[model samples]
Target chain A: MGKLISMEGNQAAAEAMRQINPDVVAAYPITPQTEVVQTFAQFVADGRVDTEFITVESEHSAMSACVGAAAAGTRVMTATSANGMALMWEILYIAASTRLPIVMALVNRALSANINIHCDHSDSMGARDAGWIQLYCENSQEVYDTLIQAVRIAEHPQVRLPVMVCYDGFIISHAVECLKLLEDKEVQEFVGEFKPVNSLLDIAHPHTFGPLDLYDFYFEHKRQQIEAYGPAKQVIVEIGKQFSALSGREYGLFEGYRLQDARLAIVLLGSAAGTAKEAVDRLRADGLPIGLLKLRAFRPFPSEELIQLLGGFEAVAVLDRAVSFGATAGPLFTEISSALFRADRRPLLVNYIYGLGGRDIDIEDIQKVGEELERTAERGKTEQLVDYVSVRE
Target chain B: MRQVLLAADTPVVVANATGCLEVATTIFPYTAWRCPFIHCAFENAASTLSGVETAYRALKKKGKISQDIRFIAFGGDGGTYDIGLQALSGACERGHRMLYVCYDNQAYMNTGIQRSSATPLGAATTTCPAGKLLPGKSQNRKDLTEIMAAHHIPYVAQTSPGRWNDLVSKTQTALRTEGPSFMNVLSPCPRGWRFPPNETIKIAQLAVDTCLWPLYEVVEGKWRLTYRPKQKLPVEEWLKTQGRFAHLFKGDNQQVIEQLQAEVDRRWEELLEKSS
Candidate 1:
């Protein structure tokens, strides 16, 4: 096993950064995500890591710098929250299209309208189509492990795409938790040296990044990028297995708890999955065939595996901390519903948009979801296909 | 830029903004650049170059990169003067050893003549059309050279492609500077300025002679005048050559011409004082 220590999500991410010792880290400060860069800056200042830390003016510049550095052929990383991630929208596409393997630590927070700095997946879910691989962490330990794996997954030849490691804003980012951290040498060995394929400094072989593609070729290039995601799914699984062997903690695209022959299940992302697991255990003790499936990799969504897993369940509730605005349900709900559409034996899927803007979600709230799922299974239909959980309404 | 990289005899990386230069030169399956070039986004040329330069430093320290390399960024007025100002200022203040060159074409020519902060007063653009209600752009152009100089970088210059020798020399100086450097070049856009393509250089020369675009440099906080008109021509002489400013010469818009002339004189005097 690895060394065990207590640290918050942001600090743990920074600690993982210290171990990896990236070549460049250009970041801007935003709430709930600032501690990651601030702590990493301390390491840079104390000469603990050989990193070039650039405190950029804004999140747009932060992502821009990362794109430049990565294109120049180096391992680069950054961190940001809701509005900050929104600012990086344009460059995020460029980073991925250019095939720059940049890793970003994204602390999930609600996007601004009423200006609430709380936990939500809206920030990352907004960038789902930006051609980035996204991993959602449940706690500090997962955050640390995911970041390390992100570097490996991003740099893989078949998956040279940017990656975003996301955890809850304040709930996981600020709250301390006891988590196992790999030794510095172990992380260094796992991440290894960054060998750039087409470095900007390689004068012998010149290349242009982010070229303007007209109608004649833009479609083909996009098709090639789509093909690249196929290998990315395989790479993510292989990396997860390798990480599992190293950390003694198993990981997959998603985790299943009491899922064998489950008549009812709750499918969700991030820390809320922990709460759902507790509800599952309590219901199981009362002889209810309930289960929970915690989604880890939202991007490169494990569609086939998910279809197979949910196929056996009679009723499933997909909880999302973000809304799709005008869509039938949230982003997760839409994807899950579409995935199940292809399944021969489809489950009665209900969408639950819950815990937005950092609203508290307790065991009772998840237990209520389980009870509702049971009723939906018994009734053979959902009364409300799309509903809100733990809201004033 | 190709010439500068060729002359340097070292590895060079260029970061370009999303504008005319980037789009015109780099079409998919073909590229004008012979060296490593990157175009991230429109408003982040400087910041992107800063990252490339920072990576060079890190790699050099780790013995991964043994050869010397230089970094440069190019942006248009729209990218450098307005949307990209914050990032440019940050890159300058952070002291990245890279040269940021803004080709001031006065307006967003790539987007078909929209007004930019570098569009001079009384100059017509699609956004600031010269019509009965208004003469042209109501405000004076931003002095980006002065703004860059205020950053106290090692080198800052305002040159024109019309003066080829001066432009080349200033580019060399910027490349050789130890710290951050900035160059604001007055690159005349024939389509946007509504001038004959053949008269691009002549119009740029007229701009310099009329004191509309001065040839000057600021080195380590000290300003130096590189060229001064023997006898400063009236701003009307330069304005009349471009159809964008042709509306200013109409009988009803003569007052607008006077206003532009006064603004030009004020800025010329300020430049003279700073150089002295």
Candidate 2:
């Protein structure tokens, strides 16, 4: 055991990065995620973390710099919020496709238009298909815990891929909680040092990096990238085991709260899951037969785990913070519906698009959703409910 | 261009097509063009050229490549002024230290007198055939030189094939520069221009004499004229020499000729003001 301290989620994330002892951290500061990079910058300045902290121009350049640095055989890390993540959209794909083990922390926030600077899963949801292993944290402890596991998962020899650790903006990034901080030497041994087989700017060896692919072989490259996502499951499990051994904090692709005998359940990701869990506890006390299934690992999206968890529940409300606009449903809703479609006995999946553009969703709102789900379970009904908990006349 | 190519002691790779400039400079195995040039074909030049240049730089930085090779991409106007623009922009903006030279031959003479972007306004080509209603191409040639300069590179210049020594000297200066440099030279094509093949050099000289294409250099944010025509010839004289401009001599077509002359005058005045 190292030290138990009360700290904000951003502080936990920053301290975890320091303990990991990364080689290069290229980042641009944005709201919610700003403090993560700020604290890390201070660490670099104070001789705490001896790393190349490249203060880049934009999130695009930050991600671009990460691609360059990581490709050059350096362990790289970065953090960003909504628009910052939007700006990094291009090179994020580059980092993933090139198989650079770059770790990015995304402070989930509402995307834009009548902008709200608060918590939502909008940022990470948009990046779901970017070939990155995405992990969502519920609180400050998980923020610290997941970041450690993220590095191990991303840099695994079998799965040399980029990873995005997402914790809700302001809710998890700003909210304070008790966290178990790991020792620097302990984390250093756990993550170990990164050594690249090929890198840019290496004088010892000559190699071609990032060649433009035409139609002739571009599909095969992408097909191989898709294939890596499957192996990532094993890597994530192994890293989770290692993290539990080192820090006494257990992690899984998905976690359940009273979900074993659940007839009605609310499925969600990020900080909202914490509130859903609280709602589940209250409803469970009232003998409401409700539960919460919090998705921890969203990409390489744990389909089997989801089916197994939801299979027991009668009706499931899948809450998504992103709108896939003009589609039949929300991004997460479409995913859940598709994943459960082929099952012999599937749960009645309801679509709930909530907290978009960071509108606040309280415990009451989650309770309301839970009550609705319970009613649906009782009725043995199926309905796609969207934009729930709306302010009505 | 020898001044530019020979300035660096190491091997200088040149990517060129089988155009007038390539034919003039290189002959089979008894190659005249040197700086240890690796001659690449036109269509796939940019990508492969970049591959070679990047490999060399990465190798040299790692102490793998023995000689300090200065890579230069040289091609006709058809190559640099149009087809290769995308790759050129990528290379220059990506901070490659390669000098890209466009010997503006005015037409695709290598393929048979077809029109290219570097072709002058009112010049006729197989595609831009002159007729009763229209004289030739109404639009003026695109200013590729300025476009290269806009990339915020260290060096970009507009030299004339008429001034051979100056062209060679500027070519050398660009190759020695640390970053990407682009040079566009107006090398008149005799076959395309409907002039005696021997008059190729003389007509090219006349191009500068007539201010048809002025000789200038854009260096370190300063624009300076290297050659100023003593008597700016009427656009008619340059037009009359080229069979492509034969239709321009007809009635009402003279207004189009005047419009072309006026645009030239306006540009020359702007260049003079900039030179100051």
Candidate 3:
């Protein structure tokens, strides 16, 4: 049994981290993501958790420390936002390729160039190819639940890779909501003691990590990293099943809301999904053949499952919170289109880039997008392949 | 590099920065190191070892690891004095029980002799060529050992490889000290400094004799000169030994050599005053 309480998303993440209680947590503060570690640091100071909390100098050091600690055979975790994640970019790949199971909480924020700190998918979307298992959450509850699940997913025997739990900055991170907290014992039993594959502390069986691969083994090592996703994709689903059993909250690669029997649909990820759910309901009530596809796992793409779920749609509008610049479509849209490229019964896909720099996406906005998607279906063609929404003229 | 290893009687876990030490020893599937080792990145060896050391303390507090082990991080001057300075500063300020040794080869020796912050004045590097308009690297080398001392760590030392006994002793003292020890050892490079391979140790010895690279330690904020020359050699003794300084012997470059010598003498006097 668990207790229900109202708390902000960052506090919820901290509570989950307290329950999980990793051996080491090396983190630096960044906006929106700051309270997550700040609360966790309080837990450490209060002796609630015995984690070796290293207040590193920068995000680069934070990730570097995580890499070193993970390779040193300790369960490690961290949290950061956009520019901080960008700072950790170089070591992010190292953590994955080295097969170190380090977990990170990424509160998504827009990247800088005029320097903004607001909800956007640009951060984690930029790291989509960094070889980490990325999990996006819709609300505070999901932020809490996904963080705990992230630990097991990262440390699974078959999947020894880093996990990034992404939630929208300020939207989900600062917004207070009622969520259930798992008993500490329950989390402890679920994650168990981390069984490391290699330990730098093992004096007898010494191992060398991150060796110079050069021409001989670099490509093969990368091939191994690629093959790792096979088991990783399975482990993610399998652990979701196990988590559902305990928590009674079912999770999947993606969640389809009123999508099964619909002809027109819109796709999105992160906190905006909650807003879209109401729009989906309004569209369904109006007798429009409209539905919603809220993606949870962005990495491993859920191509096969997405094809089966979305192939019957007449037209699908993929809403992306981040633009892909010169690309033909947004990142989420690009992935969705590529996943459906060879589908036997694919829908006409249009991309809508929206809600950048924390711009609000109201239910009416989603309803309008759904109506446009409905019109696209009625016309039997996309009016435009990619366009912006809710922006100044 | 070998002296630091020999000084540690116990087994050690090593975190190496990306430089000659890491590249020369490791080449996938084959390594010269028998101990557990990691080379994370060029600019993060200190933070990396800090992680390892923190993990050791955490696990050991729980009675998990039972080994009497030491943690060591190795970086070159490029990684230490320049690129990785922030990480090194952070690690030192945090005060982890580890030894960070900068094998001070003066420049980015592994990258075709680029001028690093540790490159001495008037020493020609590819980035600061000794051309008609230029007179080699114009800036004096950074006083990195002093910089580490400012952190007020338990141990900070400066030594060179040619002084085998002093190098080994300094390493032993550093390892024995409790928190955050640092060593900036002048690891004479034959290829980058343009000296004969056999004269590597001789070049290092000349550096110390000329007070260009002195052997000293700052233990718990108290500075001490570890080794002092019986009869101090002129700075020209060090400059003449390395081909990188060969241009100082060329026409109208005498003023640059004088400036270099004056910088060395000023630093030596400062160290002496601090020791006194």
Candidate 4:
């Protein structure tokens, strides 16, 4: 196996960056995500990485610079949080539409009108349709491991798309955890060399990026990008397998924790998945059939896999840390419900919106959800389609 | 731009902001750029090119790039003087060896004549029109040349396409400078300025001769006048040529014209003082 060590999510991300040693990194700081770039900047200064780290003034420029560097035919990476990601919304589409395989560590934080800095899924969920591969990590280990795999998944020729390696901000970001670290040479060999088909610096064989396409050809280019996502789903699975082999960690698009024969379960993303797993074990030990499916590949939503895995379960609760605002259910709940629409044995789905701006969902809270799912199963339908947890309602 | 296009002795990677230059040349599958060009976003040409230039330096230092490739960026006055100012400032402050050229058309011409920070005092634009209450843009055009020079970069200049030789020579010096360089070139937009297409060069010349747009350069920290008018004409000569300023000659706008003239004369005197 690789070397075992303890590090926080930000440093784990920095460690992954140090190992990857990309050609360029352009980043701006926001709360919760600041430590990722700061730690990486330290690596760049100490001469541990050969990356050209551009300390851009704003998140807009950060993504812009990443686009420029990635177009220049180099491996470029960056990081940002909620409002920072919101600032980068315009270029995020440009970067993905231009098909620049840039990787970023997105420390999820709540987007603001009240201006708070804490964990939430609203940030990346808002950009769900912006044509980027989104990977949600459960902890610091997953953060490091997923980031290394992200470069491979992004740069995959069939999937020349940007990837957002997202982990919970401040919670996983600042909390230290025991994880296996890969050797630098191992990561180098796995990622391989990024040989761009058309580089901006390739003077003889010139290419143009971000051209204005109106009416005639914009649809076709966008359609081609759409066609790639189907193939990208396969690439995510294949890369996960390869990563698992190298690190002795089994991985898939989503993890099934004691999900083999469970009749009631909760599906979710990020750090809450780990908490739900504990809730699953506690309920199972009490002789109740309950389990958890922690979603990892959110962009390529794994609808087909969900059909096979969660379709047979009698009832399932989707715990969302973000509200979709005006939608019938939470963002994660909507996706899960939509995925099971065509299943032969669809589960009775319920939504529990919790933990906005990082309001700590615990094991008991999740077990309570499991008990509610059992009740929903006994009732043969969801009495309440969506409910709020831990918030004063 | 034409002069620099002709004068370039080496291959250049061009970065352009969203403007007439970018939109006009690149139309999906067909591109007019013979060299590598990138246009990321409207307000980030400087930072975007900063990324490309940074990549080039990193690659060259690591011995991946052997060819001598130069970096160049082009942005409209709107991109350089307004929305893109911070990125431009940051790029210059970081000291990358790239030539950043602002095609100073003085307004958002591609979007059909909206007022930009580079739009001068008393120039009519769609956003700031010369109407009953307002007499065109009241604020002076931002002194972007001086603002850029404040970054203490290796080269900063104000030139016009009207003087082809001076424009070409200034471009050569800016490109050859070992650190960041900036050039603000007066680009006469006939459609936006409401002037005849053939009079583009003549209007640019008038701008220089009237002391409204001076031809000057700052090399390192020292200033030098590249061209000086032998007999400075009244600013009215520059304003009256364009229909955008047609309202100024009409009722009650002569005082506004005088204000424009006084401001131009003050800036010109300051330039002369600095150069000497």
Best by DockQ: 1
Residue-pair clashes per candidate, as listed?
A: 0, 4, 0, 0
Find the candidate with the highest lDDT and give its number: 4
Which residue pairs show backbone clashes in model 4? none
Q: What CAPRI-style quality would you assign to candidate 4? A: high
Residue-wise C-alpha lDDT for candidate 4, range A191-305, written one tens digit per residue = 9999886899999998988899999999999899999899899999899899888988877799999988889888899999888888899999988898889999999889998
Q: How many clashing residue pairs are found in candidate 1?
A: 0
lDDT of 4 by residue, B8-33 (tens): 78899999999999999999889999
Question: How many backbone overlaps does candidate 3 show?
Answer: 0
Error (Å) of candidate 4 at residue A95 is 0.9
Range of the 10 consecutive residues with the lowest summed lDDT in candidate 2 chain A: A200-209
Q: What's the TM for model 2?
A: 0.70
Give every candidate's TM-score on chain A: 0.99, 0.97, 0.99, 0.99
Which regions in candidate 2 have their CA more than 4 angstroms from the true location?
Answer: A44-48, A202-205, A383-387, B1-276
Candidate 1, pairs of clashing residues: none
Assess each prediction's global lDDT (C-alpha) against the native.
0.91, 0.76, 0.91, 0.92
TM-score of each: 0.99, 0.70, 0.99, 0.99
CAPRI level of candidate 1: high
For every model in order, the fraction of real contacts preserved is: 0.84, 0.00, 0.67, 0.83
